[model samples]
Target: MKLSSSAYLRAAVSLCSLLAWTAGAHAESVERAPDAPNAAAPDAAETAEVSGDIIVTAQRRDEKLQSVPIAISALTSDTLSGRGVVTLSSISQVAPSLNVKSYPASGDTLSLNMRGQGIADSGQITKDGGVGLYIDGFYIARPQGVLFDVGDPERVEVLRGPQGTLYGRNTTGGAINIITKKPSGEFGGRVSATYGSRDFVRGTASIDLPAIGNIAVRGTIAYTDKPGWVKNQGGNNRYHDFGQLAGRVAARWTPSADVTVDYAYARGRVTTTPAYFVNPSFVGSLPGYVATRDQTWTALPLPESESNFVDHQLTGQFDVSDFLTIRSLSAYRGSTSHQFVNYSVALTAPTFPVGLTGQEDYRSKQYSQEFQLIGEIGDRFSYTGGLFYARETGRHDKLQDQFLIPFNRHVISTRWVEAKSTSYAAYLQGTITPPVLDDRMKLTLGARYTSDKRSATRNSLVNGNPVEVNARNSQSFENFSPAATLAMQWTPNILTYVKVSKGYKAGGSSEAAPVFANTFNPEKITSYEAGLKSQFFDNAVTFNVTAFHNVFNDLQIDFVTDPANPAVVSTINAGKAHVNGFEVDLTIKPSSNFSVRAAYSYLDPKVKQVLAPAGTIFDRLRNPASPFSVGDDVTRYFTLPFAPTNALSVSGDWTFLQFGENELSFHANYSYEDAVYTIATAGPAVRGRDLHASEPLERVDLRLTWATQLINDRRARLSFFANNVFDNRAAQFTIAGGSPLTGYVRQAAPYSEPRVLGIEANIEF
Candidate 1:
């Protein structure tokens, strides 16, 4: 159905008004001093008072999110808890531009795609990451880090667009900054217990120590578990795999009024639950697809696997004087995972092309360190300059067995590969609050020089025996990136800004024989953006809107193994592309009893030019006068995967007085995704017939929380929250052309833990 322009305009206005009212209405009542003890913690009374300003380092300095020129979204602890955003997937429901794909084999390993750009695997041993994810200003080079649980974080700042200069390492898209809660001196904390259906149980505790001279400490721990939704069809308690244990410990020390030290350690592990392709032959093509087969089609029995992750962080800051502060950070992380699958390749039938059996083992180790000084050159200017360094090493091994290989069925073929990479960079950024214009205008500038080195080796092995290999390569490059931004506060409550920035992603080593060499070039993006932020109606509402255009060059394109080669897949440069989009966020609190938050993102992302080999699949899809000639027209054939063109989200909460101090909050969401190709393939020939297709889907979510606080102090409270209240089954993606032909599929990892009727209670003595 085509929506009229007028209807679109009306929808936009309605969404904006709803968001502005929720966040602005009660903001005036909430007043938090910067030096207040444990001020970042959740307190219903405080939240009901007023919406406080969100301080962020988007420009490499502490400034109000509304006043900063960059496009960003920061979720405070209250917002996080209220929305039940415990995992990245849940967080995506609030941030429309972000999407996280989970593999059943490795729940601990997340594949994050922001603005439709990101690595497809956690095991990928590449030096560059799509979206730079950070915790306390330290970079996380692998997607595995995004899988961690929220461990008493003060806030999470999601900066949209490239941050190549201020944030080191890989930030081709942007960055996610997680700021953990610091230790407090008031000496108090809370313990909470939660119980839900499916044997779900969770416990969390935190405590702050009394100030010792000028220093104090706080520690937090959390644990949770629940039974899975998938049943083991074969019995013997083998098929289902669910969420596992996750934990963290953090501490802070402030020995002097001007200095502070902080540290934390975290780990998470989950049993992998792999999904199988449902053959259309047995399941039919009906809207409600279901399998009719009685036995698992893969060659091997169901496989159980696991993915684990660990992280350590240390930070220190010292005030050299009244106007200068120095800071440093050190972090180390490691991850390991394994997966085994009996893949099929039939589009409509449960049939394994070569008889089905595949196993892959992956591991990675990473370390990073950074230092910076944040202070003002004078009262008119403030600056933050830093240096960063990181190293990562990983190994991947895969074994395949095709039982239907005529007489040689028992002989299994395998590929083993190892890769090591390291990266280092130094950067500087400054925000100049010029005396002119009476501090109404600011200029932000930053730059970074980064170097990446990589080496890899691949060999064929059988039964732990080495076979033959053709080639190996090692390469390195040093790149420089810079960015600038200018902003002006038209009034105390309104701000406008413009920015020009560059983004870079490093190359990697790929094992393809003929050595069908796979070497990726550094991808870069030059982006231009403009935005507006306003707070009106007595601060009862906040609204922000931004538009951006990005020019991407030498974009890295992942390669798929050429079926004929079986041992090699070559990477290629995608030439150039353009991405233009608009994002808006609103928060409104029309009255103390009602509030709402809404966000929407629309992207017109397309490939401007594609440099591909003649006749190489993609050419057929986008026929042109000359295959090598550059063009401006980008059709559906060139669209990127997981990059939905339009996204809309709405969430609201209502408090009723008749409920006797009880609060019932409900959240609902609707999303739309355009069609996209799953892979590059000769659709008909490769699949025996047409197989690949785009996944267009929509899902609704509803959550309700009922709670009451006991003890006039409100230190003790109880509430119940449920997610996926409707249990809608929607497909997020499908791995087309996988052997079993039944249209190799990967369902939208079932919204397990359905209708979680749970109760949570917290108490403090």
Candidate 2:
């Protein structure tokens, strides 16, 4: 599955040549529909061209996706539906250089990594992700609640490579922008229902009310319930089973031609069974290892977990003149989660009949406000300036109890953490098209100054007695991120750009067992990139390519000290790293009957140095288990976690029949990802057990649909889909636990879902 650099280049060249050949004879021009739901509808005269463009708001303005200087992947609602993308985790199949993993026990908890850059630990609330996630221009503060069902969105845009100056801090890798459908002035609604394997049932409804005077309103709701795929041999319970409900309401008012206001509210809830642990066969000689058949496992008990969140946002915009505008955005978001689990199955000695239980309660709240002024000077210069402020507060409370039934010995421990943070920033960006080279060359410059202050308090108790090894700490960080780009339009259909940018992520206190394990230094990255975007044969084909190199400094690494005390997690500042990669995206639409889309990514990442403090867990763990020596500077080379060496996706859609407004279509897609490591440092000696790298992933999805307006003046469609057609059981996560000295090394892994078949029906009126 490993591909060389030369192989990738050859593939790109071959694909481009094929596209040019297929589209060279076509002469039709296509007009794209606007991404904004409230934007003016397209004219009927421009609807039959067969080549449809996609509009994106990646640069804070509406433009064709092909015209954007940055490397971006944009998916519309119809595309998402066709691909059967239900959650954030499935986005990787369509987007290059993106990976997502979720804790099997809690579906709401997940991690998103792009180009080998992401948070090291999902359990730590203080840590921030390398990729920024935005919903309607509002940033999501935490990763736990990012996996919720998106319902239906107007479009989703994935911007790659250090969007620092515009996106602010914590976007060293990239950014994801989700834009939802706005309220329309017309009265309309849609309803959809789905049934699938594993007793899966899903229903969704959306309604738009006719405008009353200057106001319009819309509402949407979605619900899903399904049975778990993994069976529990010892009981009737199943792991990873869940039910979820989500709702959203939006309102828009245009009191005058020059001014407009918008408001939205959203809420979601999830309830699920905890994950089940499967003991590894390699450790079967140990007393704790329980042999199992297939992927089924024996569990003495099952745990329960729940999570919920609410979001509110308000926005206003005023058009002062034809070339000037002012906009403001305000938002608030809150979430709470609870989980109760039995840990003995995965962490305690089986022969001793140990019973270990733990409970966790977490809550978080965040508020943000932003204001911006956008102006255009003639046809030469365009600029935007913005100010932003955000505040966040959260608390985590956890309790653990251990019992030895044979010895009648019991122990209890509790830890509590409270944190608060405030952030401020001001940013400005401008693009200038000089009166040279027929005004085809442009220069862009941008900068942002950001300041962040954070404070936290940690408390602990042992067996009902207070422990003094806890304290309070505070820290502040400030940085200036700048960006520059030079772009040229060689022809009316070809554009090229080169960019250099800086990205920053603030440091914060850790919620570990020891009081002194409080904080880590900030992380930063400087990146350089060059790209080409082109359209050929009257816009029948589009091809884009990008090459980038990034230098990362002071990376934050999270590791566990002792599995016996599972809460003893620590964070350290690793010295430096380097990442270089190339990406290719292609789309071909020779005629109205067929289209093809393909993307590929190549990533090469290496850690340049490691600096672990003496007497720390990192230093102690590396003594004999890791490649590092005791006193030889302790530097080693390794790839970042979740970074696959190569990845690819190819999809096609064909419409074969059309009669009397009835059409039949077929879609199929294939995705492949090379093998990857799930942890920063993984080896057999480190955990006193043999460890295996993650298996390469391969998946194919297929869909068939029939559409018609034959149902009483309402549009109706029925579709059938099969995901993971080959049923590949690739592992997504791996963890090691238990005491190494006891000759007991327990390992747990969570695999991707098996094949799923479903049927869906949709109707619009």
Candidate 3:
């Protein structure tokens, strides 16, 4: 839907007016309380002193979450453990406006979408998504290892909207910051073990050593083994089974009062069977198809997949003076993955096989460096400036074999791709509190200049003979992103802000077989946002709301050009898109023993214009059964992929009993997402049929915990948790697989995880 500029302006004004009136009325009522004289006046710290208050570094500085002008969701270690969230897939249940999906062939590959912005195909190595992922302030260069198990972290912060001004490249959608626990000066440790459904078992351990001559050390290790949720009738092996092991070591040195140094190393390995695929039974028109059965596959030729990665980081901080600080961060990372799959369900003839077998291997290495300076001037101005540099190199090797049973024909294709990139950026941001309005108004401005150079080469072989399918290509891009925010504190417990920002994602070469279609233009977004943060009822209730509108130019889109040869995918600069959304987050602590949290989001995304490629067979095809046709604009007026119109999450925790240092608590949460289209198309018409889409997702989780004192003043806790309690059988991803020439098109989909119940035990010393 298209929204006029005047309409948005009016809505923003109305929202601000309502917030102002509400804040004034609340303040007046508080002042008129009978015990107002005895109660201390609420200050910045006092107004945010509730249990819901959290410290965040969203703007590259330490501040209260209510004080940050941007929209963000922070998940602490306690919250993660309580929710049984171990990976990014489960994180979406609690984070509104975020969705994560894996490919049908491989579960390790993840596509992350936030606020209608994300890459449709995450398998493209050369192209980066609009959202950025960071671990310990260092960027993760690839999506392959994004699902690695993160041993207990201090917190995970999800920043929504454009963050390019401070975070630099590829943050048009937003950023995810994973902050691990740092070494403490005192000795501490924890151990945990879990046993769940499907014979799943997991164990984790951590240890921290006391300061030794101004140095402290900490280490953690975790391991998990689980059987597949799906049963295979064709082979003895199961699909989607996995085993993983991960470890991390960190050390901190504080030899002087003003100097500090920290170093960390992490490594992990995972081995799992590829996800199983089955023909869609719901389509009754197709011959020999049956619905109403569990996810079972009759054919399995390949079952092994592996992924591994190692990361190292070193950081240093120096207090130049009371008003200035300098920090340096350096990191290096490497990863490798191997995937094998067989995508055929049945045999078409006695002497021939109708199936496809594929094998792929990927390896990557990267190094990055960053330096920053932060200063405060006379309590009126604070500024942060940084310089960043990163270099990455990677290789991808893929082989595919297709067999036609009826004709007894076989075809083999192989592709080897190599890529390298270098990026440099400089950014600066400053916040000033004006003398007017008693320092209640603040102005923030920031900008970043980025330069990137990337090159890639692809060599293809058909039936064991080399072919010049695509030529080597090199490209360079430069971008400037700017941000400005105006914020005012209307009351001690209320703050409102308006912000405008620009974000950019660098373009890169495509691996398509066509020699002439090797490059795409950069994607950019201009965003405007307004938000309000307020607290009432003596800091027991906190509410935050934000509305945003974004305009995207030269948006990059990836899709299959030909269904017959499904191995090669094409990338194009589709056109412009307009996205507008609103989000609400609320926390209420009705009593000391009970609390509730809820989040909701509404999004409307539409393609405003598009330029189609001429002379394409798929575009010009006049078949009524085809999704595209002659004179059709493939992208115009189409809804963006992975965008859900409405999403909601509600959670409540109740502590029913507490007796002499022992406590018992119950927690439950519910999450819902509207139906979403997995692929982008014009009005869902492909081949005169409806496009593939995912069903609405609804899930509920419950947890019960008991805690008591252990020996030697230590503590011990036990918990029982259940996820997807209702066993919702929703599809995570769906697509068309079989060739259309067979007189029947086959639909394939991979379902989400089933219900799981587990028990966990933890001991702290």
Candidate 4:
């Protein structure tokens, strides 16, 4: 519902000038010979023996996601098990510029936004997340456990903009590459089970082993149990429940073939139960509020959450000859979390017993090492050099038990935050081609130089002494982040590109900013991109488009230092901002059992400079200190938060019916979102009372399949699924938790996720 970027630049200059005038009327329109002037190609794996685009590693090598000129998306594993994506927050329903959002009182992890960047209160363990989550080449330093459970997936590349030279630093709102599905020495197995609707149960299993001598092994296990739908207090228990168990094991050794090795072990556990801040304006203007906005509304010592993680990884490769190649990655990770939240939804217990309950405990550990050197200096250019190291340590503690209604007293606040970080990076990238227009132009340049040393500490206690909180222990940052791209292969299937990148994110320390000691710096992004990767008539149809613009400097913001005390928070540096976007990905596959896909995204956020607090000006008055007003420049009511101005996803995959080898398929998906704000609206009277936007959603997913062959030559499937199919209840998140000085402006929600229907059985051996 927001579509004018000059009609998307006149439909991308009228489809690249009508595909360059029909490829110059196809007099055998050629142009695909590039690679070898800096070299870098070959490293396939996109099934069907490759070449339908989608073979990515988003620049750390393995090209062909339309030659990787940024703006990427790849979601296979049969399109994420046909749209029922498991975890990673359902992959944003199909990656339309991604946006994940769920911080359920710090439990199930999630809160990633792409286009306009993200992170507005995302399970902060001394923050640092502008999208960057990698697994398989490890690096998940936080966001809890990144929603664990991704048992069998062999693809999930999202990389949109600013990957800062082959993923360095926090990727400035981009990077997610999951890929998990290694170990292929031969024999295999898979199993799946499901049952749904609140009492939902799920199971998954996988195993593969057959190389015996050169070694090969794989294993996976997953389990999920769901319960919960509100109700707590007088209902005994329940409040958005979920439980999970996940596991992974792997080993592979090529032993020759120029040496290759891999080792992995992963473990996971997740549990949940918090969600009910449901203040529908306090039902009847607070007098005797009675539960009513879903889940039978109740609260009190009933919310609980837990997250767990463990991973050990190692990967190595060496060829040393095809122009030299060597890569290695090592990792170790550990995590633990526990939350006992009840943040709201109290039914006047014994004279408003101030229900601000929160108990958190988190612990983390990490170690990473990476080294890469992909070579070629003779064939044109092709180069990559890397060295990265990471070290992390964390411990967070929170315990608060409310009741202070204006000091009629009862407190227990206790908090202890600790963080330690050390990082070092050195990267280099080069790509060449330019021998003339015959090489179809290519030029890539990259850089990364990062050095960070972060340290943090926060200590506070209430009834047991120790108070003073405005803290920081250490901080040091350095960044380089540079990139450039200029591609053009204009016709073996068309390709075009233009890019410029720089991204960084360092800043640390802010367990909800203890009374504004205010220390922030290190966010800086400068990106510009242009894209088009096409295919027509013969490849059936695949179109990709992108257009982006970003520029934000020190833009970390998290406000509400007491909007009537919603846990009094603060994190700033909200100065200078910009975002512009456009993206579209379409697929058509006209034959081969029918297929259709669509994805769209468009965002535009603005706010150019806004660092206030000296003399009031950017009016956003509702007075809880007028949203920190002072001397203009809250930049016209800044509104970037989760950044969501139009997002869409459409799907279709039909395979009517086949007989010779038995088959039947159908999958449908529809996703839409356009309403996002998620907090922060700084001027113009607080965006005319913007109650922390969010609540424009549409979702639907369906699946039906039946592939057959089982009985030993295994390969079977039987499914039926339905997710959110019609039970669309909005409120994807909105908060301002009432009380505009008791004038009550309402809003405090967290909804979405209701309809569920299931039946699935899968096997593959």
Candidate 5:
């Protein structure tokens, strides 16, 4: 399928008209701001505190959320703790805009999709993260960091829509900003301990030193562990144990009334995690040569089969004069994972066993330094600008069991691939707001340019003998993304905005097949969005709404030459696609004793144009040599993976003053995905059919807690939490043509955690 330039331009014009109208509507109304009952305003607290926007640097400045016209949701420390969210994957139920999927065979990597845009890596080097992740303003390019547990955080800011101008590289869907607690002058400390099912144990502690007029220090640490869930064929799933440890220290110094400085550092690591399946468990089809259940799932042999990750972050802030301030942030992240898997490949019933194992090791190191100068030079005009520089190096090595299978006496096949890459980027963004027009409107524009370089070398050897005759290749490319936003504040509590932006993913060499040796080109997206936020009924309710459309070009896709044999796969530019959606969040507090928050999202995603081999028939076949044989007629189709068309989440906490000020909270969420097809449509399908392309699912979670003062100012709480309370038989993953024993379709899933009961205690000193 092909789209002409004229048609593309007409669509762009329509998008622009929609944005303009939405912005105009927001400019006609005004509303009040939500009250922060926990902390006083910065001016009233005797400090230049952060704003109540919950999350910012949105629009490049510190402004009240009600005063900014962008759509954003924030989870503060208290919110995360109340919901039992410690990692990105766990937060999906609370944040309706994001979905995280697990990779069955690879324990070290997890795939993430947001607003219907994402790509799962298949031995490539194209840097394919659709949503950008920022830790205190530093970019994390690798997907490894997205799966780690970093413990309690100061706040998580989920900005919806394309943020290309401010955050460079592949922010086609949106961005997630994680902000850790910073040093403050207050002196105090808290420690908490918790225990639950699956041998779950967690501990967290934090301390803040009292300030002596000028300086203060803060420190934090946390730990967690969860036992295995899958049953092993040879034994219990003893190897599924996983845990994380993190620590951070920070300091803030004020030498004078006009200047201040802040610095901090943090680090963390993850222990062994279970990789229990060869493919999705519910896909209903089986590929030849795979196990029906977990076989190699057991405790590691001296921890050699465990996956681990480590990261260190540093940041600094300086008040460079009353009218201007400068801030800098930097970080280094690294991870390594190794796992041995089980597999079977023949499509025969009562699948036979094939001892299949694979190993992957990746090391990614990144450096990012950003400097920002913000100030108001005159009463009529205010401005902010920043410069960012980042450098990253990645090295990956993968080895699978197919290469070790013995073909002939004293003969073994080889399946080993390696990827190494280095990338650098520089970006700048600035926003201009005029003091005139009663400060009712602002115009912001920005752009970023990046250069990406990659090189890969693949070698196959059979029993000390070379098979592919030494294959080597390399490629590089450059990309530029630009953005613009128009916003207006009609009232203190209501604001509206419109934005247009472009998103980009780097290009790199593909290792699918030796023929053609194709190099995937850069994928780009143009997006338009309109959003509104307001507080009504005297701050009792806060509501936000957003609508957007995105057009993708030069979409990079992995094409398989032999659908029957997935080993012979390659990459190519697959034409175009589009994504349109709506999102809303509403929070209502009828009174001080009770409050409730709810969120929902609706998305319509489709493939506009997809190219493939002509007259391909994707279905089961038995013969190989004939032109119409099963192996030669493999087929391909365009479909979205892991994208739920509609999602709804509702939660709230109510407090009682009569019963020792007890607090009770409950939360639940449900997501519905329109079926998604797995890899190849025509071939040995997953689960005896094609992968679960169009399937609907439902999940529910509930938790209740009771808290009150015990003795010596100590606090005690009893809690009950149930995940997937109904034990719904929803599949967690789906894979095609993975194992011979499991058939072409395989499902290795993450069942919902069973019901759990726990007790918590916290002490203040």
Candidate 6:
């Protein structure tokens, strides 16, 4: 279900014109519902009413998803539950403009990329991600523990493109807003259990209490245990085994109709074995060797990676007057993790060759406070303004990596790193409708000013002596990001808008490469977009399309330096880059019993210039040490990390039968990702080939459910699910490497998960 960009655009324009001819003959389409992140309306019942509409908070205020003037994909509670989505990566298939993957060495860490902009090295403590992750208006500074299940949530909003005014910091790419269910004064609860292949088991429970003297509370708990499928020939350890337990408690109180307060405390822990890396064919085909590619068994033992986190949040809202409302959000969060990762293991050989391994123990804590004012000034004007502040500190001790932990170990390197940052910001946004064209056009303007201060110190000891380099200890920055949009209503069912925005990520020293830490600058982007939102055939069909172009300056890109020292990595600022893309999503609900959704994205990214310091490693054709280092412009060789040329997803839900207090339904989803290039390995090793690009991936998932009413009038359901139905396991990442002894070049490739089959049972009261 893919269409050419030009053809799609033309068809959309033609359809809008044809629909407008009869617009006056029909009443306005059903209310455009929203997906509000700040409001905890369980199941979206309190926010959206129309069958095809969604309530959303993209502008920090309740608005319809179609009316936000931004590209967004809302995953509602029903969708999440029906699809059995348990982790952050599970949403990437439905979010066309976004990409989520496990970090290089850790199985639970996350790497997010939106429209060609994201962090290449999330393992670096000081580096910030281009995309921001938020939980009920609270920002999570680190990626650890984000993959755990959170029971059932109200909705998750994925906003694509620069969101500088509302979400100020590190949003050059986009943002993800995760909103859990809020408490209702009525008593209700839910319980569920699931069992799957490979000994996978999960259980979850949640309860809500009746109101008592204007107070209400809710509690939730969940547990998951799954043994790894990849077996180890020796030792009990296995690759990808995972176990997690998480819980949360939330409360709300209201003394008067005008005042309300909410609080929540949550904690969670996840433990996992590192991913099993496969040896490339080149290295495995050598004299008297065995390749691990697509293998089910390994002689090398993999270690475990574990992370724990605690979070606290408080929010207060006040109605100052009939036209204005004030709100404040405060939060404190902390996390710690211990991981020993092996990128690639050359196993089952006559002589065991220990692969590259790294061990890290890290802890971080952050506190944030935000205040917002949302209201309309008059019949023609509306506004949203806010102020924000945050502080974060992190420490990494006993950080070192080389060959196997104990076997074939050579040079022992150890390091201790500590970093901290403080931030302040203020922002204002407003919308105005002039007395022209029958008030069908509106203009919106917004801006934010942010200031950040950072300090970092690295003390590395080789064998016993501290390293010689004295890294610069501190840095500060100030930024002003602005946004503007013009939206117009052509017909009751058609809306169009054009917008421009700016965003940036703060600069910090690379904790791994102290000498190059102060050598890079903050990365920034200016984005322009034009979009169309429309519904045809009396609200039965909906279509949304957006075309975007972004200009990037001082782009931060990471790469390994000196193959002999793979443990050391550096981040440098590439001078200029540009990304152009388009996104299209459609939904058709011909009847209440059946619905279908499809999304597609296309991207074309090019590197316009490469900075001198970054070019040496980014494109070796210009490096003095390379044999092909003299021919083409650096742009000819480099591509952004995790950005694919084309991505598409299609999903359908059908309720085919109903019999006396019983129901039956089916759900199916399919997604495809084009090949992507991320590794920045050099020229001679590349041999004029695009070895950096990984193979394309295809996924299919299906589910069937049966529901019935119990004798006591409670609702229950039973379901069976199958994921990766075809078992199309493709290598997600591949890289060239060398042993610490040098000249023994090797290759590393990691594949995706295999097929999974499971059954689940659930009940609600």
Residue 755 local lDDT, model 3: 91
User: Against the hidden reference, what TM-scores do the models get?
Assistant: 0.83, 0.88, 0.88, 0.33, 0.81, 0.89
Which regions of candidate 6 deviate over 4 angstroms? 1-52, 281-289, 293-298, 344-354, 401-409, 468-470, 514-517, 614-633, 680-689, 711-713, 738-746
The candidate, 3 or 5, that scores higher on TM-score is: 3
Per-residue lDDT of candidate 2, residues 120-190 (tens digit): 66666676788888887888887655543443677788988887776634578888878887876655566
How many residue pairs clash in model 3?
8
**Which residue pairs of candidate 2 clash?**
none
Q: Which pairs of residues have clashing backbones in candidate 6?
A: 33-54, 33-55, 34-54, 34-55, 34-56, 35-55, 35-56, 621-629
After superposition, candidate 2 runs with Cα above 4 Å error: 1-51, 147-151, 234-237, 282-296, 347-357, 402-410, 468-470, 562-567, 618-632, 683-692, 711-713, 737-746
TM-score quality measure for candidate 6: 0.89
lDDT tens string, model 6, 1-765? 423324433443343333333232221331212232222334343447345568888788878787777888898877888888877888888887889888756776888889988887777678799888888878888887774356357788998998789873658888988888878755556777788988787777776655666787887777777777667666556777776777888888877878888899998777777667666553544353344543434455466678888999999999898889999999999999898765444322224455545688889999999999999977899999999999999987664444553365755577777889999999999999999999999999999999999888777777677774445568888999999999998888899999999999888877767374554578889999999999999988999999999999988866455443554666777557899999999999899889999999999987777544533433354234543342234544455767889999999999999999999999999999998876543322334334455679899999999999864345789999999998888876665454211222444567788899999988775
Which pairs clash inside model 4?
37-380, 37-381, 38-380, 38-381, 38-382, 615-631, 616-631, 620-686, 637-683
Q: Can you give the lDDT of residue 39 in candidate 6? A: 27
Candidate lDDT values, in order: 0.63, 0.74, 0.75, 0.72, 0.58, 0.75
Model 2: lDDT of residue 467 = 84
lDDT (10s digit) by residue, model 5, range 1-765? 323323433443343344334333432331212232221112211122332235356555655556666667777776777677767766667787786555554444556678876665532433566777777666777765344334336667777776666663446677887766665555445666666776677766676555555776777676666655554435533445555555667766667655456566666554544445434332344333233333333322223244455566655556666667676656666665554443333211224223344555666666666666676665544555566666666666555444222331233445444555555555565556776678888777767766776666667765667877546667777778887788887887788899888877766655556443456778889988898988999888999998988888987655555544555555566657788999988989888667788888888876666544321222133223224333331222454555677877787676644454556545444434444444423223223544434345555667677766643333555656766667554444554444321334433333333345555555544
Q: Is candidate 3 or candidate 5 better by lDDT?
A: 3
- Over 4 Å off, model 3: 1-52, 147-149, 234-236, 281-295, 345-353, 615-637, 682-690, 737-746
CA RMSD per model (angstroms) = 10.0, 9.8, 12.2, 22.9, 12.5, 10.8
Cα misplacement distance, residue 248 of candidate 1 (Å): 1.9
Report the lDDT tens digits of candidate 4 across residue range 16-74.
34433443343143222333221122236645335455677766667667666668888
lDDT (tens digit, per residue) of candidate 1 on 588-656: 978866778788988877766655533222333323332333342223234455566777778886765
